[model samples]
Target: MRSCIWMGSEEKRMAPGQSGPKIRLAGFTKFEKKKSKPYSYSRTAKLLERFKNRMSERKDAFGPQVERLTVLHATVKKIADVERAKKHAVEQTEEVELVE
Candidate 1:
């Protein structure tokens, strides 16, 4: 039996009368071309800009109604809070009078 040791500076050789490993020559391989879609940044930007403009226009049309509803909601909440505070104050006064 022989040791299959290899050295960096030496070329590849085979043992007595044995065939060596086959070498592959460099060659270009044939490849299929794939069809792909091209992307455009300017078209995407224009679409986004158009969408924003439409959204702003729609918001403007309903802006006054939206403001009125918001104000109405705030007024109702304020009234509820005032009523709650008055009830809490009365409860505290009754507790103090009973203690005295």
Candidate 2:
């Protein structure tokens, strides 16, 4: 039985036609520092102004309807509270009569 030892191949020699300009290998540390534009206060102010205008327009369109609904809700809640108190009073009177 013959035992064989494995050996790694030598570095590849470039072909004669491929020897002109060396190929550049891209690496993580080779990036250029990028220049960022400065923030503008005027642009931010304009955006905020437009947002506020749209919000005010929406509030103006729905303000009266919202107020009317709120008032109706409060009136309905008051009526329900009054009916519940009356029901409790009637139950108390019935219980007292039964006790007597």
Candidate 3:
């Protein structure tokens, strides 16, 4: 038995009792797909550099954002410690008020 398969813009016929995969052909249409521009060597190198920097910035695979957050947390903690120490020192020391 002969079989016909409808391809992109053409029809494909199969031999009698021949079981085969249908082949598709590229067809031209009103809205043809736009071809992508090839990446230049410099552009590719820049992309690789950016990717490497991002990967290196990660701390122990915690991710870049996590690394940033950790740094921020450490800074805040340090500031808080300093402020606490200052408050403690002020409380321990005597402060005299001037009489007007």
- Number of the top TM-score candidate: 2
Candidate 2 structure lDDT:
0.59
TM-score of each: 0.37, 0.39, 0.32
After TM-score superposition, the amount by which residue 39's alpha carbon in candidate 2 deviates from its true location, in angstroms, is: 58
- Given candidate 3, what's the lDDT at residue 99? 25
lDDT of 1 at 68: 58
Runs in model 1 lying further than 4 Å from the true structure: 1-62
Q: Which pairs clash (backbone N, Cα, C closer than 3 Å) in model 3?
A: none
* Highest-scoring model, lDDT: 3
- The lDDT-based order of candidates, best leading, equals 3, 1, 2
Q: Worst lDDT window (10 residues) for model 2? A: 1-10
lDDT of 3 by residue, 5-42 (tens): 87889988888998877555577334667899976444
Q: What is the C-alpha lDDT of each candidate?
A: 0.60, 0.59, 0.63
